[model samples]
Target: MIDLPIDLLITNKNKDKTVDLILSFLSKENYPAIQKITDSLMYEASGRAFIKIQTGCNKFCSYCLIPYLRGRSQSVPVSQVVRQIKTAQKQSVKEVVLTGIDISQYQDGKAILTDLLKQVLTETSVERIRLGSVYPEVFTKDFLDLYSQNVVSNVKNGRLCRHFHISLQSACDQTLKRMNRHYTIKQFKKTVAQVKKAIPGVSITTDVIVGFPGETDQDFMESLQNIQEIGFSKIHVFPYSNRPGTLAGQKEKKWGEVFKKTKLARAKKLRDLSKQLEENFRKQFINQTLGVLIEAKNKQGEWVGWSDNYIKFQISNPNLKRNQIFKICLS
Candidate 1:
């Protein structure tokens, strides 16, 4: 652990040091530490645990400051990740979420994200392994095939969770190019189609940014139409706001910033679509049995938790214990 633990509080530059500081507190000398613990430090007395498997982003998308603020992508060793998950399992943790700033870029020597996942699955006995936001470029045939065989087929036993949160900022090719996105909309569509075909009843979610600088009316419409066509289970919508020192921020004056009112209006349109899409995705699972990990009882005296596909739900079963998985049927 580093000597100056207080540095974590002052600035964002010391992202790597913060990991060391967390390990110093959580682990004794005999125990090991993951270089990266899911994106942030999130631990609860419930069944699920979050571990940052990687940190930082190499994809300096024009609008984002994550690369400048957090530095380049760095992955935790596979052995360390497995060790941490095993320790959590010993503490009765039933679910482990592998998270990061950009886990899709995770690399430790020759091991990539898929390799790390395989190691975790083979070495640990965590009931569920959920993933954080994965960049679209990582979804190669090899990766999808591995997921189909190992994660989708083994859903009955609750291994890897059957949910994908893809980081797709825009659907219009021109807007995406301006935003410096690595993959085209067509590539993303193909990947999603492949995953959907491989895993039945899978939940796919995504993020979208509306009203980016210089985004035309046609561009906005394209995003809306394409997103609806893709049919994501849910979407997290964001209005474009300039981040200081980023490429988009510098080009704001030249590109002409999107009007505040226009941004809000566009955001509303996307959000409305999100609601419809979410309802449509959830409709298929109605009355179907799902594996749910009971995390806690809410203030309403009902057990609240998430289904294996990442749906938040509540049940009124008094016999259910905290930190346990149960087969629950949706009504």
Candidate 2:
């Protein structure tokens, strides 16, 4: 019922500094402006879409580009977002991820995240709905309670798999402070524990940066200890990529080269640990069947998919098509 032009932003080309000035203040919430641009582009391509409801972050994680690139926190109205979801459904998007620069930061005064979820799932026609990143601080009791139950409370082949990608950048409290990460290890641990206890069998993943401007050996050890304690299914480790306009960059410019080298080394170490973590996590899947959504066609005519819990699955049968739901028995 809403008229808007959804445009795709181009991220290619050879150092096109001329266009950089224009992109600095682009707001994703301006849907009519977006649709104007997308309406033209869709004439050539099929529409597989993204609904980014939350816009920006207030937690200025030192090594991140989200706050500056996306700006401060703004959430799309539930009515408007549901309208977009209905539109995407008409176009045959089998699943949709509710994304944002910082979805956790979205709170329209009394209208909170749980309210938005109730509105979306209850009213909309999205076949499958997935959430974007959620912050550690706001992983409240209400979120866990509503999302805990699978469609039929069927433990084995459950529905409505609500996963969380929590940000626990460094398990070490000291390193977290140096990186200007707001939450502490104890607080983060307690929050995570409570969430897991609330939502059993929920897939939890995280992000960790091994080396920062002021991380020490003891700090790295502490991080590893916490990672071991959490037993996270997966982790994306970035060796602290520094960007300008952040406080850390300003303070550590003189030690840039040295810091970068240390970061590289620490990154390698963390990566090794991450692989071990994955292998350990995989052991839990030794004899389990998972509901997977096939999303890719691999070489040799195989179909690949991701489980609702976010595990990768591969099948060699060419008969299966992309975006089809399948039950995968993992080894």
Among residues 3 or more apart in sequence or in different chains, the pairs in candidate 2 whose N, CA or C atoms overlap within 3 Å are: 5-34, 5-35, 5-36, 6-34, 6-35, 6-38, 7-34, 7-38
* Model 1 poorest ten-residue lDDT run: 30-39
Candidate 1, residues 1-331, lDDT tens digits: the string is 5677442242353345666756765565422333334334356788788887888899989988888777899787888888888888888898888888889999989999888888887888788888999987777787777677767324445487889899889999988998999989899899889888877777899999988888989999988999998989999999998888889899988877899999999999999999998888777878887778888888999998888787777999889988888888878
Model 1, position 245: C-alpha lDDT score: 89
Report the CA-based lDDT of candidate 1 relative to the real structure.
0.82
lDDT of 2 by residue, 1-331 (tens): 7966835443322124324424542644332212211111011011235676777678887777677776678777777777777777777666667777778877666777877877777777555666777888767777776677532123432335547888788898877886788889999989888977877656778888766766777777788888879878888888776678877777665433336677777777777777787777667676787666777776866777776666777788767767666666888
After superposition, candidate 1 runs with Cα above 4 Å error: 1-41, 152-158
Judge candidate 2 at residue 187 and give its lDDT.
Answer: 90
